[model samples]
Target chain A: MSATEEQVDHIKQAVERWNAGPVAKLLAKFPEQRAKFVTASDRQVERLYAPEAATIDRYAEKLGLPGEYPFTRGVQPTMYRGRFWTMRQYAGFATAEESNQRYRYLLEQGTTGLSVAFDLPTQIGYDSDDPMAAGEVGKVGVAIDSLADMETLLDGIPLDRISTSMTINATAAVLLAMYIAVGEKQGVPPEKLNGTIQNDILKEYIARGTYRFPPGPSLRLISDIFAYCTEKVPNFNTISISGYHIREAGSTAAQEIGFTLADAICYVDTALQAGLKVDDFAPRLAFFFAAHSDLFEEAAKFRAARRLYARIMKERFGAVNPKSLMLRFHTQTGGVTLTAQQPDNNVVRVTIQALAAVLGGTQSLHTNSKDEAMALPTEESVTVALRTQQLIAYESGVTNTVDPLAGSFYVEKLTDDLEVEAEGIIKLIDARGGMVAAIEQGFVQKQIEESAYRYGQSIDNGERVIVGVNKFTGDEPPTINLFEVPESTTQRQLDKLRGVRASRDVARVEAALAAVKQAAVGSENLMPPILAAVRAYATVGEICSTLAGVFGEFSESTN
Target chain B: MNAAVKPRILIGKPGLDGHDRGAKYVAQILRDAGFEVIYTGIRRSPEQIVDTAVQEDVAAIGLSLLSGAHLALFTRVLELLHDRGADDIVVFGGGTIPPKDIPRLKEMGVAEVFTPGTPARQIVAAIDDCLLHHSVM
Candidate 1:
């Protein structure tokens, strides 16, 4: 990319001459569609990017070779040529038996990994029969209240052969404990357990809002899992520090990177303070991002995120391991972008977002089904969603090479600009004394809320076009089959829960529960007692209630 | 309801799921439109919402839920409002609800149901209209 002074001068003069002659003449007649162009993130995009007047000097430092330091190109040198990104459809609903059927069907359809979406009751640590769980059992996802349910959930699936990712926080310890016990029953040892848990709690407080215990005990639980996983479940990923929810909450692409990494930095800082080595747990830490339809900005945002996180780990935390510096992530198409109107159009939206994720070099992907905005995607739409990824991988030529858009002048400029933008946000967060303090002071929530308001306003005033919503008109209400979670699911799950309670060793359960609370009160790693409790068939509600007594619940500090 | 005074309303989120962007945005819109708004943060129960509406003596109760439990949760709120002799409080709803259920929700005594893609001005106008025409008002 090096050029002599004469070459630069010639390029600049040629551009000026053409703009004055042809460009000026065309502008007087044809004209452009809009006065100014902007990305979905509101970044003002230039008509064209040129090296004649732009900064593209630091090639080696800023955009290194794939798999090298500051991995702005791609995390893997071979990229998809080595293997396509894991096609994981995050599916779970109804009873464990029903969800198990879905998982086996997906695996048969060639999904490489399994992602379990627990019901709201399970996510918030309520058993099926609990009063708070009324009318909500198995509504959004599969319900797992004890080791028995986890066993049924993973019934015929071989643990050692497949990687499972459970999207559970707040009660992540209890769920992971259940998962481990299930693995043991299948003759798969802890070391052979390959999977991830969305154990991130910061985003729960900031965006997702599934938090249970307060910040103190929440951080303590996360650190304990990190330490335990590094030792016993050596192949397991302990966390997926998520920005998917943050973006769903309407933050721009920049805030997605800024706030996610700030939360990550706090997690690392917390773990280190608990006496864990950075290299040990940092390698297993993962990220989750939403793939919005802003093609170039979405691609560049991923590149910028990789570079920013790498630099943060190496320079800020003094890390030496290369794996610790690499930013590995899972991408799910943005759920918020799917419009309930003209649900079929969502198929097209998911396709473009999926392409951006692939071009950005994601490690794994979950394409939101077209009908998700209305309800949980039906089986047919879920198949089409999975086929979207399959089409891009097998037909689209973009994944034939690594980081195909790496050298484009526009993408490179965006990469640099986005990195700078995110860093500025992180700096503001640090000025408020790190992420925990910022979240406690409601700074993080306020930033997201403002961005969300602006985004909503744009849609309302026709500044933003959501096809079938703001622009395209429909004369009559359209009817499409919506997936309904049968109310019988609650009754079925409650019966199973009652049976488990009637059959399990009551005395052993009490002992394990006491041990869990003792460990929670003291400074011991909580994984052991939690595993014991799960193995003894203690319900999720029982274990969580014990911890809640010690660590109290975290209520929103409303502004 | 008088032409000079905008009715007060309590916007509440009642469910396990915490998708609150819509709830917060509506609260902001109503507040800006000269209405007194109390936003019950995420994860409130129907009892809490009904109790708040009674205590605040608001003209309307706006509920939001994205967890697909809206039909049951909103029904519970309407039932509680009826039992408390506060059935005069206009109950309105919004979330990821489908059009097929809109009639059912309206028949359940929810004064209005706003789905996705609703304009801010329309929400403020609808609530104002709902309050101005109420029999108790």
Candidate 2:
């Protein structure tokens, strides 16, 4: 509802009196930190927010009740009142067996879900023993070469009980197939398995650069997964259209939502063009985002994303299912914001980010370890990170009520402003023939590059303060012992790969790969053949290379 | 300050690590600092890095790795330079290298190793110092 002129005048008078009296007295004793207060995205924060500051014309239309159209408040009707946000800590490193131990440890520590982190070699579709995988066998995350590794990775973990999320792209199909096979081995049907794979490959081209194939083939593979999972694994999220990497690569909150939804638009359009019903597959679609340091802005970003996505699905695509309209998402704390100097300061930084995620209504969250800026976090550090979420869920009173910050004038204004700005960017992308074509023209990459460069310059010039990093100088050697993968890990992985190759049926492996190549050349879904190959114990490198021979590899045109 | 003889540097990312924000930022800052910079985009092998260094005839090589493969990748690039008779090129490394590994990286013929929180000016000054010392020798 619009404010009356008399009410506006009264608010103005009160603000003026407050500013002239107490504000002036305080300013005389101490000065403001900066002349202008801005958000992480450079949006100016007003001196005071009031009824006039809100941009909504009618509350019912824009800010409807929870679980209704344009779900701005939250997705679920009783968010956090029914249960707290899922505390899913992303942990994986070293061999599959070792990572499996970590997963069990987290589960025993009250982790609600499992999020797997694959090593670089596995992420880019290389086998552990490949020459390209040397010195990187298990450096960043767990190494999974075939069904044996996948089996070992999930040895004791109950597949039907625990929902797992794999942070894998480019090779998502292969890993998904391996996951399905492992479920079958555990006497669980594909329909009972539930999880999310970071199948958003366009972001890889724009932000992460872990892409293996060109855009055309990559989109085809994703389309195939959407079709396959719709029938085979109905409970699983087919694609987690991710903004986490984009934000980590240094995008503003609006850009994170803007580019992410743009990519989602491209995927939805691609699936629709492939003759799939929108309601059939869109229900399982989920999102992943980054929760940075800005409290209100981050919360507003999630709200804006939900509202914007609901409108897009309803108006743009004519999706009838209410499930298709709700923008469910998982959030991870921003790793780039952590500092190597004064590493303990990262604990405070992570607390702020995790709280932002929880307050923003994230469905699941992964809080980063404080020692991550130096290396892979140790077990002690990871446990502390997990306990940070525990403290918020059990101890903090923020989760007691739903949308606790709902009526704040500043948050509401920020939400409206960000929605409009992000819609403007999405319109520009739609004008250029959607995100894939835009990425092909290097437009998205250039935008992120400019943003990252500007942020770096801000730190370089002292315009932005990173606390202990650029200010509050300190001199202390790191006291925490980093978790280091033994150099023998590579040798051990190679030995296991050899053992698998010697034992697996050679004819079955060859036939499965041949089928994969043929499907790559044809219009058939590649998941079945890929699953067959994975079940036959063909290495990831073999299947990927076969398809690469048909679909070819991608090399980015230097910007 | 002559334009014709600006010290050329090759900024390359070795291995499958795709985090190129630091590499690209350093490239731009080096270019802004009046040096010719050529960037080999992500996922360049060690041979490709050294080959590009020789082919471009760059005065120095700036290698960035965030995948914990800095020791192996950096040493391979240095060994390749030595093998190809391009040992005069000043080599430096950056990106998430642990503090303890910095001394070992320096001992392996890397002119310097810049960790996180390093200013671009400090890196540019290090490159300048390396070129000055090389020219004097």
DockQ winner: 2
CA shift of A212, model 2, Å: 0.5
DockQ of each: 0.69, 0.73
What lDDT does candidate 2 reach at residue A522?
Answer: 94
Candidate 1, superposed: residue stretches over 4 Å from native:
A1-21, A52-56, B1-4, B135-137
lDDT of 1 by residue, A528-558 (tens): 9999999999999999999999999888866
Across A1-559, the per-residue lDDT of candidate 2 in tens digits comes to 2356567668879999999999999989998988898888778897888765233446766778788878888889999889888889888888888999999999999999999999999999899878888777899899888899999999999999999999888999999999999999999999999999989999999999889999889999999999999999999999999999988887889999999999999999999999999999999999999998999999999999999999999999999999999999999999999888888889889999999988889999999998888788888988989999999998999988887777788888888888988898899899999998899898988888888898899888888888887898777766777778888888878888899999999999999999999999999999999999999999888989998999889987784
lDDT of 1 at B135: 50
lDDT of 2 by residue, B1-137 (tens): 56567789999999999998889999999998899999999999999999989998999999998889888899999999999999999999899888888899999999988888888889888889999899899
For each candidate, report what fraction of the true interface contacts it reproduces: 0.53, 0.59
> Whole-model Cα lDDT per candidate?
0.91, 0.90
Go through the candidates in order and give the clash count of each: 0, 0
